[model samples]
Target: MTTERQFQHDSQGPLRRIVSSVFSIFETRLELIGIELSEEKERLIGVLFLGLAAMMLTMMALITLTVLIAIAFWGTYRWQSLAAITAVYVLVAIVCALRARAGLSNAPNVFESTLAEFKKDRDTFN
Candidate 1:
């Protein structure tokens, strides 16, 4: 009975080793994939920051130019000049709206693509 038990234990040794090896391979692969995902997320955040900075700079420049123009034109015309100034402001607003729409349209659709890729990876692993 002791000899039979020894045979049974010996038979399980290789099976256990194989299972452990398979698990180790899977774990290593998961680690590598996690590293890749983290790098990608960092890159995306950098891009978002750059876009935000550019937008802020553009708005600041626009504001500065508008103020300079208003100051330069102040008191240069009749009382009806206020109406003209109001019209100019309206036009600027419309132009700004169009530019905002264009910028939004051009923005990268990275979120959807990233989500889809992650879902695909998740399904593959599952």
Candidate 2:
């Protein structure tokens, strides 16, 4: 009767409310993480595919141009032409490698949003 109702009400008091709020927070954070993960996956796949295609086409062009240059200079400066091409390729490759290394260091954190959200929640609770 009255005591039973009080018991039920007390059971659903601040502690229960706090637990429910925490669970809701966790649910929201989990949903955000899942959405971010999907977006990251899509972005990574697109970059990978596009990079591979570009590399393949550029390689073909390079081979064709190299052969054409060698053939054009066959009589006189053939060896010098090949040597110049080799040196230029080495320099370009070095520059590309350095730029890629720089890019890796500057790459954005994948979980930055998640961590930011978590920090916001913490600040709010504090």
The number of the candidate with the highest lDDT is: 2
Q: Which candidate is the best by TM-score?
A: 2
**Candidate 1 C-alpha lDDT tens digits along 1-126:** 999999999999998997897687667666667776787799979989997998899779867866666677677754455566568778987998999799879986544544565576568668
User: Model 1: which residue pairs collide?
Assistant: none
lDDT (C-alpha, whole model) for all candidates: 0.75, 0.94
TM-score of every candidate: 0.50, 0.89
* Lowest summed lDDT window (length 10), candidate 2: 7-16
Which regions of candidate 1 fall more than 4 Å away from where they truly are? 68-126
Model 2 CA deviation exceeding 4 Å by range: 1-12
- The count of residue-pair clashes in candidate 1 stands at 0
Model 1 TM-score, 2 decimals: 0.50
